[model samples]
Target: MPVASPIPLAPVPPMIGGGEMGDLVRDTDWSSTALGDYSSWPASLRTALSLVLNTKGIAALYWGPQQWLLYNDAYGLALGDRHPAAFGRPMPEVLTDIAPVLSPQVAQVLATGDGFSIENLSMMMRRHGKEEETVWTYSFSPVQGESGGYEGVLLLASEMTQQVLADRKRDRAEHERAQALLRLSELNAGLEEEISRRTADRNRLWLLSADIMLRCTFDGVITAVNPAWTDLLGWQESELIGLSLFELIHPDDLAHTQQGASLSADGHAYARFDNRYRHKDGSYRWISWSTQPDEQQINAVGRDFTAERESASALAAAEEALRQSQKLEAIGQLTGGVAHDFNNLLTVIKSSTDLLKRPDLSSERRARYVSAIADTVERAAKVTSQLLAFARRQTLQPTVFAPAENLRALASMIKTLVGAEVELAMDIPEHSHFVIADPSQFDMAIVNMAVNARDAMVGQGRLIIRVGPARRGSEANEQPMMPGDQVVISMTDTGSGIAPLHLGKIFEPFFTTKGVGQGTGLGLSQVFGFAKQSGGEITVDSEVDQGTTFTLYLPQASEPREPRSVEAPHELVHGHGTGVLIVEDNPQVGAFAMHSLTDLGYRPVLAINGQEALAELARDASRFKVVFSDVVLPGMTGIELAHEIRRRYAGLPVVLTSGYSHVLAEKGTDGFELLHKPYSVEQLSRLLCGAMCTHFSRVT
Candidate 1:
């Protein structure tokens, strides 16, 4: 074999002419790269590299298995910081930031021997000193070697960042302009539809409304009238049109109507008033007008409320009649109850008196009869007091006292009243709560409620009396209480609740569900009266078979002054021949008083009326030790007489007495000692002695 002459080495390919990238490629140590030296490079890679280098656009070749980078000056310039150092590096390493996006695309082109192209391909590149967002139109084309196998990938790119941004801006502006125009058109269409709808509605209202609609000039000349005017006033719209609106108004209403018109003329936005308008039959109909003022004109709607007014008047009359009927019925019930109760009391008294008159009666028997009479009289007095309380006409002595303290004091008494079978619990707050009210009446009310609760529970359930501070309207179910701080005393009982049908009438005097002798029914009534008279409200809530709660809200009072210690009861003391002036209108009562005073060892003088008493006093005022007068007199009232006596006789004690006097109840005792009627001999003696003692002390 001819010694194989050393085949001449293949000549090196000419260096690419890509300016800066070309110079870098020529100087690079390509043997160190996977693509090897350019002298051994495949024909296809050399051709691709030549095209990429000389191309004006951005282009690069990723050649061989390693996919080494060979980019043109334009592509190198686009590479920013990566530049010449990237010339001979592997494509994945050189384009590290975009490898994720570029690798798969390049692999696809190489494997399929296909070309891939995309527009606006976004890449984050470290261009300058920092990574920046750039967009480009780029493609990857496969390069084939001499053996017809895919060698690597060729990349061509054109930056689209500025172009794409500008196009998007212009498109956005056009879209916004289109949207604005569309909204404007919609607004115009909607406005037209709204105007048309409103106009149609106005026309329909004018035709169908029952109220008389009219337009008038500020000067009161009618410009237009709707058809309702014809139907309402029996005046045709044509007849009313162009006529002075004031002509149709009743003479009595003309002045106010003109004044209302002037308000509209003065540019008041709205005016509402009631006036009488003339009907076709010469009768006057009441019309309620609501007018709106427009430029130079007033549009008014007049509703004919004549029937409403007439109905209101008729209703009021009927209500008054009903009230009168109810009042009469209540009076009948009260009269019947009082008669029945008093008859029982009088029967005992009459029997006792008849027995005491017997000469053969034993001492003990005579004493028992007299005691029975006295006890019966006391019971009758209590009945009258309850009646007065229920009527809210009882005298009240209001003083500032701690309700909590009072409740605590009465807890034991309440327990006894509720009995051993019923559980009685008191929830009095630790802090003191003060209220201005009659303490005796308050205690009585509580006892009455306790008795009522015990009876409702059949003497065998729970009674909880809770006292706390409250604000008016703080509770949703409570009645409308006066707005202020309030002391709430609530009694809750687990008992058979009151019937709904009876709730409203429970406060009415003599109204009761209890059979004959079981209850007088004045207990709750008295409580109700006391609550109202004390400037407070009482509310009850109950459910059938469940329970009941009676809540009393009293106006809270400021902390009271330290209370003075109560004095012990005084023993019955004789008058010791002291002169007593007795003024009484009733003959029988006056005679009884004189006898009682004399029996108590007092010298007594009688005057039938206040003027007679004054005359007697003028005769010898110093003769009387103390003046005792009945409150209701023929000429001047007892309260008036008391004032006169005080004015005339300084430091002279005048004691006023009454069964029931509106003046005394309303104006109070007027700083004078008062004795309730139906007094016992002992009571009379004690009061007279106390009054005299007080006077003596003052005089001394």
Candidate 2:
């Protein structure tokens, strides 16, 4: 409805060039509208105008010849005490010092016939009598008067010193960026050359390595070969280049080599193949190859195992043949020697007994003859036992004890056996030396050696038994019997020394140089057997007409044991007066023991052997109180018999008697009550009394 009288609008500003405003609105132009009545305004008003419009509070000012009329309170305060006087100053005179320092923007605008301005143009301004520096900016524009005539110039300026400095900093940053870009271009140009140099260096390194290296395509075509690869094959790298790896492989090994290469290519991180490769001279050598795949190529390294492989094969063959020969030699020696010794033993026993049956022998002579026969037979049996021990057929009864004490205990007997003709000496230290060995066997070993030494001295030379601590060094050729210390017992004789040729075989069975009945070559062998079986070693040193020394090294004991003295009565004595059972299969032996017991004032029960003894036991389990039996019986053995008796009579004193101690005393096999064979009336009596005393003492 109001459209009829729609708008008679006020005239718009002249459109010089069409735009949001007009092209005439220059970026550098600063124009202002008067509020009202300029003539009526006072000096105070003028001052306020200078701060807002004349100065650069929010507004800026321009005057003649593009001079800076005034900035603002911000600009004036920066000018300080002479602010108002600084108004309307010529732009050159006002900023003569600062203009030179500004960028070329002002000069450019003036020379180009264009109104130049910037909303945040920055500059540093130094006012008179000021100690600190300040920054500002101005706009340069042509002036026009009301008469439409060209006047001077005008300036619309703002203090933009912080902004101006920031702009200059941006320009410096752009220049630095350009220089950096130029350096980067140069670095990129050298990158390819550096990469090539590193690759060459890596190739040289691979060539120098001990391992043979090769680079190949996925198809097994050799692309590059290191000097190691060429040297190992006795060929040049050029000869291998572009050649298939299969060409170098032995014909029989090609299939496996291909399989490994295929596996490496098929996503296996690495694959290995050991095979024979053909050398340049047409020979095959062992090579262990390891390969890894990378994208489309394969890298491989190999080792030559030919020399080691051939040596191992030869060694294996030699060792196998040697083992067979050693086994056969040992068997042949044992068989041939054992048969001869057994026949000789049989011959001796037969001949000795045959001579004892002469009819002219008187009772005394007959008794002596019978005793000699028994002694010879016993000696023959010992020979067999020693042979068994050498053959490792004899079981040893080992106990942990001091070897020194065992040797010392045998001192008296050794002295007696050596006779008063020879001076027997001992060198034993006072340390607590130990050994895991059979005390009786050890004693016998010492005695046999002493007897040999006595014989060697012709019963008249000095004999020295030396006992000391020793050990094998870490670099020793021989293995130690035990983990630590060893007790050495060496017997030296200053008599007829052994010949060098005879030294090695002195410990061999039946190898004596003496006439028949003078020596049993088993003496030294027995010593050897006892030492070896007891986890020890024996060494003999002898020189012709000089002397001989037999050293026995026994393992040392690990811990301390209660002190014990091996004492036995060798004279006539009384029994325990307790009930004693004498189980003997042999009538003569039994009657002699029975008479001995009667003489000892002890009650005796008679049984044939283990059978009769066990029967008497079944009849009355604990009636007899103490069972004395022989070790080797008719039906059951003595140890078995002890077990049976123990079942019926637990804790009953069972005394085991043996010839040469079948179950050794060291092992504590039977009970503590054991009577060694050929026991005198006194020994039998003492053992019986001791067992009874021990039994009653335990019971009480």
Candidate 3:
């Protein structure tokens, strides 16, 4: 209901009105209205009409119970198609569509005698030949009679439909612009991540290459130098770092190096740039360099191709002169440049294995990093195996399994890892559903996510892991997904949310918000990688100071995968007391191998090299059933030894071991059963027994 202010009635002065409605009011026959004939009208109604008729403001009056409509010319313009027809009719008759809407307001104004006003109130009225939505600002005031009581209501109104519609369109356009900016922001972040990855790869290449390499800022400050600096030039990395690169250059070749350095600083990089640097032993070494520069730093690889013969030196100098004169363009190729991704792969394997050798390193993390080392092999093969591994990231052996069950199994461990401070919650549905993914990787991803959430909450908050059906029609972050029944695994946290600026980069490799060395920034990246690789996607929703939710949408599998059957668990396979020849140069490793083999029911014979093993075999070839050898040996390499044994002993099995070697990178394991060094008794037994069992089966 609406209310209206009181309008004091004044004396009529026995006259008519003025303005456009003056002539109409003077000549109208008001007999049809409830006010009766025009001459019989009361002075109070006439005075109110006289004032309304002469007024400049838009006003209308509803007099008597029948509500006869009277308005000045200003109000008539807003009355669109019903202006003249609405002159004498009742207000309800004139606005047939909106009578219900206006009747209550009119009744309230007359009863309450209090003024009411509203802005942008919606109404549906007949306009443009159809019912159209409208917005209006109007005030209803109660009109008074000569007795000083309420009579009828006064109306003041303005239409705002056009302005409201225009503003809505503008707001929608702005929203679209914001979305576009977000996509652009994401693209820029992706480019930054690519550059960062390339930089890390270049750093690894420089550090591991069998050459002289240095990393420097654009301003000529050397930040890092390869270990070869000490081996080849008799200068420690600490002595050379923080010094200007130009300080060690040969005076004769300084001009040439400076020119190349200048070009690199300006982003023009080329291969085959040659120069000379003075060694700490007072001799000059001829070095060839290839450098690439980004905004922050320069990555340069240099090889010293010193000549032993005078004639060779002259020939090299002539070739270098000709090469420099002919080379004018930079090498724009990116694919052929990652020189030693293999070294990085080997580094990971060696580092993780070394950690595994420690008495206190936990088994879970050892398995995790070792698995990471295996994944690193794909990238290493890209350069050495002539296969594109970076082109096809992560190789997974996916099987259908229920995510809810896996989570439930791991809940106790997760709670322990997150500590007792944070509350853990699970919201899995009662019914069962399954998705296709790697089981080990699935376990690892969840642990990584739980640890990440724990860190985000600073070790105290609610962490929720939920599983349910994905909402198919809703598009998250405007990403398109495969059409299917998708299962979702959602991990939500009641911690500080990600900012808009950081949201676009949270999944990039090596991008982290944690302090240096605290995070690898690969947890969420692996989650995203696995989701996409398994034919699904991941989405994040966050708000500052509130919380975040990370959802993994995976295509639901129609049927559950059959579980693999294991014949024996925790069973040590034993040899049948046949002689096992162990070829190893390290005395400690040889003694350990002898003890382990004897413990496993094999009569072990120890040898220092391949020749000793061959001699042992020749003494009585029938006594030796298997030859175990390390890949790197004193006189003969293990790979060369394997070839020799294959030639001499056709039926003997050769098992080779190494941390990682150039031979393995180039030619691979070459059909021999190979094991990485520092293997556990379990892994060693598994390989040796499997090899022996295979040989026995083949012979029988």
Instruction: Tell how far residue 313 is off in model 1, in angstroms.
Output: 2.5
Q: Whole-model Cα lDDT per candidate?
A: 0.84, 0.68, 0.76
Reference-based lDDT, residue 446, model 3 = 84
Models sorted by lDDT, best on top = 1, 3, 2
| TM, every model | 0.68, 0.43, 0.35
The parts of candidate 1 lying over 4 Å away from their true place are: 1-210, 227-231, 234-244, 269-272, 403-416, 429-432, 471-482, 501-505, 543-547, 565-583, 598-626, 633-636, 644-650, 695-700
TM-score: model 1 vs. ground truth? 0.68
lDDT of 2 by residue, 1-700 (tens): 0111122122222422223112212121222212122333334333333334333233433332453444444545556565555444544555565546432444444345466555653344456665444455556554344445433333455566666678788999998989999999998999999999999998788868887888898778999888876677788988889998788788888888788778778867555568998889999989877877888888888889999999999999999999999879867876776676667766766765676777776788667767766676676667766775554444466778776777788888998999998998888888757777778778878888898888888889899988767746634224345556787788899989998888888888767878876876778888888887777888877888888888888887776656567444344365456567888888998888888787777778889878888778778765676888877678787778888877867768888776543345234454446775656676676777677667776788
Consecutive 10-residue window with the lowest summed lDDT within model 3: 1-10
Question: Residue-wise lDDT of candidate 1 within 340-415, one digit each (tens)?
Answer: 8999999999999999889999999998998999899888888888888877788888889988888888989988
Candidate 2's C-alpha lDDT?
Answer: 0.68
What order do you get sorting by TM-score, best first?
A: 1, 2, 3
Q: Give candidates' CA RMSD values in order.
A: 12.0, 23.5, 23.6
On a 0 to 100 scale, what is the lDDT of residue 240 in model 3? 90
Better of 1 and 2 by lDDT: 1
